[model samples]
Target: MRKIRNSEELLGQGDIASRRIVLEIADRTLDRLDSYRRIRSIMRMEGSVLHIGTRSWDLSKKRNVYLLGAGKACNHMAMAVDHVLGDRLTRGVAIVKISEETDRLNKTEVFVGGHPLPNEEGLCASKKMIEIVDHAGPDDLFIAVISGGSSALMSCPIDGISLQDEIDTTDILLKSGAGIVEVNAVRRHISALNGGMLAKRIQAVGAELIGFGISDAVGSPATGDIAVPYAAYKSTPIGPDPTTLDDARATIVNFDVADRLPKSVVDYLMNAGPDKETPKAFLDNTYFLLNTLPDSCIYAKEACEEMGIPAIIVTSFLEGESRDAGTFFASMAREIQSYGNPVKPPCVMLSSGEVTTQILDNSSIKGHGGPGQEMTVSFAITAAKTKGACLLSIDSEGTDGTTKVAGGITDSSSLKAAAGKGVSLYQSLREHSCFEALSAIGSTIFTGNTGTNLCDLNILFVPAIEGGR
Candidate 1:
């Protein structure tokens, strides 16, 4: 459903045909990856047997079928499961971010929670989920739905560790520029439900569990190197790998987050015993990866080709500082214009991955924006007068960081427009407050909640005709 709310206004600001093509690609990508649509195609009941991906379950043999999930997109996933299970669904619960979509589910009990950070509501929801898993029996089957934001959306602190401690630790790690893998490594150590702990809890009572996940983290190829020549659909397990603890410790020390972490967090990590560690494996359980960032990127590329635009899947594993990545893309655009290298002009260069922002320590720099916005602003500064180029940077979840705005879009005229408004684009980037500056130039994008998350999508569109600007 109209995920990009300001599409008409946004398209009006840039080269119309180019904007339409890029936005259409985004729309089709989201539609192709919609949780409900994907779940329906992948999961179905054939007679008494429920089929999910490459696995099947004999529902006739189960005592009860329960649904449990948490994430920004879990509500949609839950709804799809509820419809599929119908009256056979005994009970269901999902912890979701607070949004207009909260009350849409009828069968599943949906609890509103915080995102990007855990709050009391999430804590309460976590307790309910734990109770559900704790009460499950061997005859029961749990269909767990996990997606992006599940780590924070289902925050259950370990004993002796307060919610405040978990919150403080999360804030420190996020601001410290730790990637999701590293942050989740630490989270698995600190939480009661992360890693494979949830599976452990379910299996402890001899209950059967199967997970359907929309992966937001970069996947591995077993060799530990990033998977290359990205695949549209791939499945992998979720758990605290054997190396998780060591990685978490390294991240904390390497980023110097230990000193700034809460005392409880520090003590837990420092004194973490084998008993407190998340298990590397959960026996007799299975997890299926339904979709991912790479999947969406591939879909976008196919859409671009259908529209007669040569598209390049630059990299699906984009990472590092947001402004730096923006600058790099801006430079690439310049190169394409000047030398016609990198697939020449009139091509769409697409990349998918989460970027980071290193917030300044100075308290006076009170700016609010997410990595996507910062990236767009940075690109605007670098590609100030470049012609026939437009960039759209957005977090797939439709909410970039703490702001309601999804992200920002920048065209060749973006910087000029900002200047006309007497706004300093570079100053805004320096303050990490791009929302206001982008808003001043009608570049801020708004999409309430896209009902999905697969990291961020950055689209660089150069018109098919040279000098289109």
Candidate 2:
């Protein structure tokens, strides 16, 4: 299936050659990262045995097999497991950021959970999952498929903290300019499900847990051998957490969000002792690492190579302010086109990581947009200097923030196009309305539930100058 839904429209305008190359590479890379296909390839059933990666579970020996999942990509991950287990699966519950009609399941109950923030549906689903785990005995087995965004999608706050508190905390931290690691540190410490609390719950009930996870943490190294059991798996609701109470406290102070956050949450984290800390390790559970943030860049590089285009994986650890990053990428494009500093022209620069947008005052906001949209808009302003320099920035899982589109694609002509359409890209960036601006110029990219969540996937295509560099 085509991942980029508006490919034809995108190709009809602005640096068509560069847009075509970027879209093709992105589509192919997204296909390669589909968790549903990856899970199905490694998991199967043979009579009474369940085979997942290098391990096999004897379902006949177990009393019940339950599937529990939550994440942006949980739809695909959980569907793969639900399809394989079929009748053997006692029950399944999956919380996803978005639920589509294409999803097929027999026993699993799907919940459309909120991402970037927790919602009532996610809270209800979390309670149900807790009930299932708490009822489980030593004879039961659990298969957990977890990915990024599980923190918000599987929201269950600890004692004294209301669901509103969690939501407010998330909203505050996200706009505070703190990195995801910092945000998750505070979030995981206060949550009942995230930061390995679900695994801890399963452990308390003496249930066997085998987890299939995709680590979307920025700077995470590329995954090796998906078939081998990964021992270092951490974070999410299904695995042990590396974040500590100290880390949580440190984040609040570092980001200076202590005064703004809910007082109940502040008191809990401040006074909670060693007993309240999240589980740091799960020695008994089995985990398999699927894909990581670095894998996105690696896959994109491979896609470019397949098309005979030289690609440079500039960095998979891209972070910082979104608009600023776009400006930097545009500057790099200029260098590559003019001086050929970073591998010369006719090359693709691939990068993946979580970039954030800071919004201190909600009243200043005008329209909808995310970090990826902001980045491309910012790039368009400066990319006007470099001819044929095209850039594509998408959230990778399809939705880029408030907009339904994945992200935006822009090139040298984008600035002119926006000016002609009476869409002020500068005003859009100032008002944080990149989506409206990009949409007005026919530059927005759309691909729903891409089956992978690796933060941001940025591809910059800098074609060689008209003549020799």
Per model, state how many residue pairs clash. Answer: 0, 0
lDDT by residue (tens digit), candidate 1, 1-469: 2677788788777566666767788877777677877678767888888887666789999998988888887767888888888877888888888556444665678887777889898889789878887878999999888778888888888898898888888888888878888887788788788777777788788988777777777653211111121222222213434546777788889888777989887777877777776776654666665666687788889888888789998988999999999888888888787677777787999999889887637463557888999999998877765675788898887778878787888877888888999999889887778888888888877876566678898999865445532
Task: Provide the lDDT at 16 for model 2.
Answer: 92
List residue ranges in candidate 1 displaced over 4 A. Answer: 101-103, 220-243, 360-365, 464-469
Per-candidate TM-scores read 0.92, 0.99
Model 2 agreement with the true structure over 1-469: per-residue lDDT tens digits = 3788889899989999999999999999999999999898889999999898888988999999999999988989999999999999999999999999999989999998888889999999999999999999999999999988899999999888999999999999999999999999999999999989999999999999999999999867889999889988875788878889999999999989889999999999998899999898888999988899999999999888889999999989999999999999999999999988868888999998989999998888999999999999999999999999999999999899887899999999999999999999999998999999999989999999989888899999999987634
Please name the candidate that would achieve the greatest TM-score relative to the true structure. Answer: 2
- How far is each candidate from the true structure, as Cα RMSD in Å? 3.7, 0.9
